[model samples]
Target: MHTLFSSNILSPPPAPATQQNPFELLFNSAATSNSTASASNSSAHSSPIEYNLLTRRLQDERRATEDARHVEPTAVRRKGHPKLLLMGQRRSGKSSIQNVILQKMPPTETLYLESTNTVKTVSMQSFAQFEMTEVPSQLSIESPEIAYSEANFRELGTVIWVIDVQDDYLSSINSLVHTAGFLAENYPRVHFEVFIHKTDGLSEEYRYDAFREVRQRVQDELSDVGFGHREVAFHQTSIFDHSIYEAISKVVQRLLPQLPALEALLNRLCSTCGMQKAYLFDTASKIYIATDASPTFLKDYEVCSDYVDVIVDIKALYGWQQPAKKPAGGSDADDEGIGESVVTFERNGDTYIYAREITEHLSLICLMGKGSGIDKRVLIDYNVSLLQDAVVEVFKV
Candidate 1:
């Protein structure tokens, strides 16, 4: 709730003013003298000199104080979970897979072309007891403006490509491959997961055969693009099948260990902002942190220069007080400026409570040091426990 700006400069107090009456009398006298002198020197000298010696001295001192302040290089060690992106053709069961993984149906529907126009993000606590972000197809493909925003892609850890096994559209395959190519080109270091969704639609015999064929097609396409078949992992999934859920759990277990901290930071922000989804803007980082919370206080949150790793709260902005009210019909709320809270923490810094609420979901983003060099999965598990405790505290208060 508190943000500290570390500045060495101590602005000087204003110069003491002389007694008003006395100062006025002196000014009057000076003016009279100056006028008389000007008349006397009219034929010889020009106007009397107007000097502000005190003002000049004050300005010089202020500049010197600013110059004296040092710019120390401080490292920011952020500790959080990974960002996961889900993508696939229309109605490829991407949302269904997300529901299975998150262990809850999305507040919205999961159908063909249901997300034809926008991208959606779901924040959840996985069975693995780790915080994970599920980016649905709506927000990924339909809304290009939001999808490629700097905030959207910067924290992304893994891109999960879901495919419907029952749909035999070759064009869908091409689109999927192209999407992968685009992502790989943009984010070479990010990991990937290709899910063959809707496995329940096919019979046991056809399911296995289709799964194998889909895997082969993905492998061939990836290989053709020079992305080795081994680089990607494939999964056969059906939201109705418990076994599919178990398989996904295993995949997440293996991948969770490699997730980065920014992902966790984002999930916390989304949950706090009450935004069903958000796209990141890199330029916004210049003024604010890379992540965004919904119900945007303004259109963006800026970074506070006082602290190297601190984001400025929207309330602190020059003009950000009233927030926009939610629209009727339970539609998503529009982001105004930045939200009231600012998320700040340093890597290797002391543990602090960072919590926010989006609608009913409460999340806490914490920073952990390298004291133990703990495994990534282990770190996530620990943070999830901390988040739950923090949420409970929010309700208690």
Candidate 2:
């Protein structure tokens, strides 16, 4: 589950969720192998077809999870949520990335987030998906336990190394070469994607030059360390804009096996509603989990993202950003208020934007044509209902 600005778990998580965060949540509606094995022991006795279904469902659920905290690696590499280690020195914007994606912390709030002072594995309560750890600079990389653990070499999918381009560079480069190059030689399968972080403050020329010069230096260091074989993808990332979220979304989409099915459903919704496009966005981060197959132009994505920002801003102002101030002896429904909205406006032309509640943390955003007649409104509402039903069915799995 995606957490809100200042919280982690719900009021009370369900069952085992309190003790150990289960990885599978609405984000990962499907189940994972480790979870399934742990869920029902009797499942193992099922037939081949049944087992196949179970495995696929587990994998799907793993992908659906919004964010998972890191767990200590055991001697053996157990099947679990794929690991994503935020590797960088102090003040490299590592926590910003984690808070932005995991806690859904506002970019501004991240400025005040406390610096991680120790090595700790953070996991969600409702489910434990893949593990994530904010690897601070002070970590002892030379520790034999961590270096010898098979899980360290086999489980990680990506190491998001951050480079604070505006900061002192010589020390960061040396650390990058020693740490990343050693892993490249052993963990050839692990991907290396670097972020030239905090580039929003740089001019275009500086941004390009910084990106290029830093990337080349890292590459040269890797080559010197005999890790030049594999390519390292680089990005200019900033928590202020949608750049980091978009980059993380691309990294995560590769892990979602249910993505095609979700996209197909969105495509069907678009056709049925006669809308231009549809997106299932992770509400906190404002990143679209899935979108219709219609080719996405930069302008279209920007428009949808901006509309989502408006919805969030309104919700923050008057909606459920905070718990309702209930009357004494309040009824259960009293706590439930209107968290969804439907509004129409002009942008290039008369446009209709409908925001529907998908989950407590997810929402459906759609782009409708200029028609505002009564009949057109009904059609839009009708299709939205269908879309919700489909989503419910998806969650049932």
**Which candidate wins on lDDT?**
2
| Alpha-carbon TM-score of each model against the true structure | 0.41, 0.62
Per-residue lDDT value at 172 in model 2 = 84
Task: Point out the worst 10-residue segment of candidate 1 by lDDT.
Answer: 1-10
Per-model C-alpha lDDT, please?
A: 0.42, 0.61
Residue by residue across 1-397, what tens digits does model 2's lDDT show? 0110112111112222222211122322223434543423424233344444544554444333423322322223324455677778889899888877676688988888778876655543211254566777777455563456776756666777888888987788898777787667777656677888998889978899988999999999888877888777787788887778776665555444345446545665665566677778766556676777676664666677788778767655664445555432111122255245667665554566777766654578877654433466666666666666555444433
How far off is residue 81 in model 2, in Å? 4.5
184 Cα displacement, candidate 1 (Å)? 2.2
Question: Once model 2 is optimally superposed onto the true structure by TM-score, how far is the C-alpha of residue 346 displaced, in angstroms?
Answer: 3.2
**Candidate 1, 271-377: lDDT as tens digits:** 43233333222111111212322333221121222221233233234334334333211111134421223242457333322322222222222222233223343
How does model 1 fare in lDDT? 0.42
Instruction: Give residue 107's error in model 1 in angstroms.
Output: 13
